[model samples]
Target: MRHLFLNGPVQNGPFTFATRPGKAVGIRLAAALNAILGLPPTPHLWNTVTLAGDLRHREADGPTIPRQRFEADLITDKYPPGQFPVGGIMTDTDAEVARLALEMIENNLCAGTLTISRETVPSCRACGHMTGTGSHPCNACGSTDTEDRTGLHLVAELAKDRPVLDRSDIHASHRQQPRHLQNTAGNVAERLILSRTRDHGIDLSPHGLDGLVLDPRVGIHVTVLAAARRHEADTAVMTITENAANHIAAHGQHFREHGGARLQYALHGYLPYDHTASLQPLHEAYRATQAIKESFETWFLPLFSLRTKTATSPEQLPALFKHYMRAHLAQPAEVNAAAFNAVQHAVGAGNVSWITNKQGLANVMAARRAPIPSAAGPAHG
Candidate 1:
């Protein structure tokens, strides 16, 4: 058994917790998950409108919160560098309270406290000007102490459960033909007709397209997973690609081999088949898109094995989710030409602007450049 110890000032000093129950879950607990699945040391996601009545989510399911005991002896004693008596030298101690406190700390860790380590120190950055015989200058920065900055802090590490992808074209180029076809020109063309009818909920017969090629960038869709860590509010995005899909499969296998639970999984992409107009052609195309998307998910699943240990692979995930687990995967609503034109009109020229329909890739990327409309709010596009 191995242990990780982080320093912090959260009442308890050093503590230990178990990752596994009596039996190993087969897969080793992800270190990143351990780092995040707990109460945050700072208030970034959950907010408090008032003190005492603080509004923050606490750890209900974390490693430290588990009620199991592991077989081991963890001892913390301050002793001189010499041989000492084994059982007769303790001058003062409270073993029962100490044991209870350790148990509580373990419980909290199991409940996702995410609290690794902490410590309290004087406000050295602001304490630079106080002058007196007994008064001491800031230990960090030499100045008279004026104010105190005291609070709990954590030394944290992050773990991720996302599939990695290689941005290089070569990696994508080697994926199964179906996946590549679905991502490239073929799926793009299929999506244009699907979006027009499916998104508007209308018929597609009136607008004739005997000969047309849809644009890939404007039509192809991908699902993204989003999750957050303790103390962090920014949602991390994970765009599932061929490589990522395969990685998940491989990871599952690795878990099974290592005395872990076996996962019979499927990468299910949500299909959008809703349409307002009762056009036959539109309905046919909408149905076809949904079928194709489902087929793609089935086709992509059997191409890989689970990974036993961490190793280098050729994969690329978006920048925001390069290092964490808990991501989301969803197909965003399409942005049409008229909507694009409207966004341009509203933002005006000279100043740069982007267009997206709150739920697609464009909108996700556009969110970084400007204040994209909230899901419940209206926008020019």
Candidate 2:
């Protein structure tokens, strides 16, 4: 199976990796997994189709710099200087993603899964922003005056045959399937609005829904598939948190599969990055170097999150740190082929138990320093 892991497109919000390392967890996880699999790098995904993005752009040189350029600039700043991504960056509204989204929508329409229907939605009278079903003031333009407006919008009728998220929709081993997440994600409304009035997005003008754009939730799925299609990956595993997965699962119902490719969410947990500094004492005791500490925080912890599937508490950091140091100390002079192959297969099979094994971690660390396998092929990230 050709599997590619891609980070769920992060919102182009105000935060850098240096300040909020949590934001880069998904990106780091994807890169680490792809490296282990001997697959080329995959493009990092970004979500620019947001109302906050519109207001931010307008506030900061609206006419001077393009929104795309604005979002790209912010993403670049998130990376370290001179260490830009080798896989490049793919935004939600990229031309290729837009084209593929429209094509997918068309196919869904033909299959009667999606429709162009007239919807009476509340809109801000000031900026014409879709305020949604709420009595509160508009998020955009801060307008309290809202009125119901009728327009042709893209709508999706939730299928009755299956839940929004099923076991098959998750990238997990049989024993680790998240039944609770599956139940929660399927709790969305039966009918969904797939179009929004965002300033920057995959425009639906081509479908005659003028001034409307594809909802970011659906665009997120398309962005992953778009990246997967580029790499010729049949199975695209999107690294995301369970909370995020539940939020977008319903909207992505019809967007998960297209042509011969399939998209699956690999649920990961939250890291207590704020508490990492407290591990300095433990670091000293273990004689852990800066390199070992950095690796444990950035790489190992993200992989550990895949196993935990929920918030890893601050109290657990010290033990986790000690575990990592032990693995670092156990690193062999060379990677054992048999051990490395098992680790690789575990990754491909969505099994993460090997992550906590000391010997397994040592073998993986050694494998990272070795020459790339001939099967790794050319740069694709």
Candidate 3:
């Protein structure tokens, strides 16, 4: 396949989408786009390799469970019972992801783009966590006491041939390129330490960097590529926010591509899901059902965020809901192949204008309602 949309692996923490809809924005956006393209639903990517996860596991006083099982259980609980992701879930710490990360590391090392070198880095005196260079308290244990720790570390030697992120690395068209992000994401040191102190991660033990793990920033990219590789997708488009893309862009410099597959960031914005309450009046006016409201919030707003790129304010909710109502009203009785093809072209071209265009939106809605043709043709047609 040419392009497959995947979420920038979301951090698996103790939060539900019911409580924090914003966190699921990337996942929802990816699902919406992939559905439009008629691709099999991509696995929901998750980031479970955080210090907080380590702490959560340590603090739990129940029957002992493996770290991988612990994270998987937590992720399963995040979704409603039997409402799990259609394509299932893949985490950063999954064996598939670990395998891919190691493969990429070895390849980069062979290509001289990465190296195992002993370097001094600040370490938490209490917990042995890499505190990085800052004098601030350790992120893991929150202790200010630290010491310089030197050991074999995985170091990434960024390419000088091009910026960390460029137009080709983004899923947007040339006219919609994120110039600011392209410039800012490159603002990092020439060399980056890709190894980190974590209880559980893609261990670099094979490379003699025992006890160290690949950084989550880089693992996140691997998570996407692993999924893409499974689907045989040549290009994996990760749905992420501009801020998130900026944060991981540097670390993912070399991890974005593996084998013949490549990864690109599709920048989206924050949605004021908290303010969706304000749409109740409009919902009542349009006689929106519970499912209709969900479609607007979960499906439509996420696509709109792709265009908004900043923040969708509460004040805009009413108008956005009204626009959706109009599109819903315009939904055709039968799916129009020509109109739907045009919408697909727009999506593939990184043009999100059709999201707000009533006719285009209706065409998409109609397509979603249309029955899928069975592999053996309609059973009773």
Candidate 1 vs 3: which has more lDDT:
3
Please list all clashing residue pairs in model 2, or write none if there are none: 41-381, 42-381, 87-381
lDDT of 3 at 20: 88
The window of 10 residues in a row where model 2 has the poorest summed lDDT is 372-381
Which tens-of-lDDT digit does each residue in 1-381 have in candidate 2? 899999999998999888999999999999999999989988999999988899888888554898888888889999889888898999999999999999999999999999999999999999899998969999988879999999999999999998888888999999999999989988888999999988899999999999999999999999999999999999999999999998999999999999899999998999999989899899888888888889998899999999887899999998888888888888877667778888899999999999889999988887787763333331122
Q: lDDT tens digits, residues 1-381, model 3?
A: 489999999998999877888999999999999999989988999999999999999888732898999999888888867789989999998889999999999999999999999999999999999998868998898899999988899999999999999888998878899999999999999999999999989998999998999999999999999999999999999999999999999999999888989999999999999888877778888889999999998999999999976899899999899899899999877666677888888888788889989999998897787763333433133
lDDT of each: 0.22, 0.91, 0.90
Winning model by TM-score: 2
- Where does candidate 3 stray beyond 4 Å? 372-381
The reply for model 1, stretches above 4 Å from the true place, is: 1-115, 119-259, 262-270, 276-381
Output candidate 3 Cα RMSD: 2.4
**Tens digits of per-residue lDDT for model 1, 111-148:** 54324332233343462211223457743345664454
Better of 1 and 2 by TM-score: 2
Can you give the TM-score per candidate against the true fold? 0.16, 0.96, 0.96
* Pairs clashing within candidate 3: none
